[model samples]
Target chain A: DAGVTQSPTHLIKTRGQQVTLRCSPKSGHDTVSWYQQALGQGPQFIFQYYEEEERQRGNFPDRFSGHQFPNYSSELNVNALLLGDSALYLCASSLDRLAAYNEQFFGPGTRLTVL
Target chain B: AQSVTQLDSQVPVFEEAPVELRCNYSSSVSVYLFWYVQYPNQGLQLLLKYLSGSTLVESINGFEAEFNKSQTSFHLRKPSVHISDTAEYFCAVHETSGSRLTFGEGTQLTVNP
Candidate 1:
């Protein structure tokens, strides 16, 4: 079975532009979480979606938003991107919250470079 | 709010030598701890996690982490290392009531020949 998969392995955008990255969760999983990994730093959680609704969110601003479709795929949208927004965007999938263990499986991630 | 701190930013050690990566977290509520490893050009992979039960958890790859509630720490250790073990290690935590994970700055482990 395929693990989590992300689209557009790499992307480049100038400031004030908007970018959208996509991800497909692992088979049999229903939860998707997005993270931002800056150069030389660990990933910081952006948000998580369950049943097409956002269940949890991090300290990110309103410029960062996401959507989860019924098929369990997710899309992360960043508007008015800033230079600091340039980073690797990772998508992780896991089983539902009711499960005993929620070990997340991650995708290769989409590299977004905002100039 | 939960936060994680990986004490070492970089650690260099000879192959087959033992190593330890320190991690500490702060959370007001009960939380789950995790350790993730990232290789070049790869996403974060779960190395091990601590939810409940025994405080000591081991990974199939010989890596283990012990959760000390009193100390508010989860330290990763391996009896011996290999060159292929070189990678970035991250410590993360999430409240038991939530799903969002807070990560540390990360520790770079270099196992030399």
Candidate 2:
């Protein structure tokens, strides 16, 4: 079975520009979540999507948004990005809403570089 | 709000030696704890997790984490480290009521042969 997949592998954008990152959920999984990992830091939760709607969100601002398609794939869009937004954008998928026993499977993240 | 703290930023141990990486979390509600390992240039992979039943959880790779509720800590330990075990280890906590996870700054483990 395929694990989570994300693209493009890397990107470069200037401040105030927008970018969209994509993710394909793991086989048999329905929930998708996005995270941002800054250099030398752990991954921070961005938001989660289930059944084509956002189910939960972290402390990120409105500039960060996401969508879940019917097939459980997801897209994370960052608008008006700041230089600080340069980081590794990670995508994770789980069987369902992350219950007690469910573990998330992550993809090779898309590295975003903001100039 | 939930938060995690990993006491060590980097840890180096001789191969075959036992190792322990410290983690502590604070949450107002009951939470699920997890340990994830990320190899260089790779995605984070779940090593083990503590959900409800067992205070001690073991990963397939012989790593284990013991959850100490009284101390609000979940420290990952391995009886004998290998050079292949060198990677970044992250501690995360997800509240039972929510799906969002709060993570600690990772600990980079380097096993020297």
| Stretches > 4 Å off in candidate 2 | A97-101
What is chain B's TM-score across the candidates, in the order shown? 0.99, 0.98
Query: Native contacts retained by model 2, as a fraction?
Result: 0.76
Among all windows of ten consecutive residues in candidate 2 chain A, which has the lowest summed lDDT?
A95-104
Docking tier of model 2: it is medium
**DockQ, cand. 1:** 0.72
Chain A TM-score of each model, in the order shown?
Answer: 0.97, 0.96
Clash pairs detected, candidate 1: none
TM-score per model over all chains = 0.97, 0.97
| lDDT of candidate 1 over B1-105, digit per residue (tens) | 878999999999999999999999999999999999999999989999999999999999999999999999999999999999999999999788778888999
For residues B68-113, what per-residue lDDT tens digits would candidate 2 score against the true structure?
9999999999999999999999999988878787899999999998
Q: What is the DockQ of candidate 2?
A: 0.76
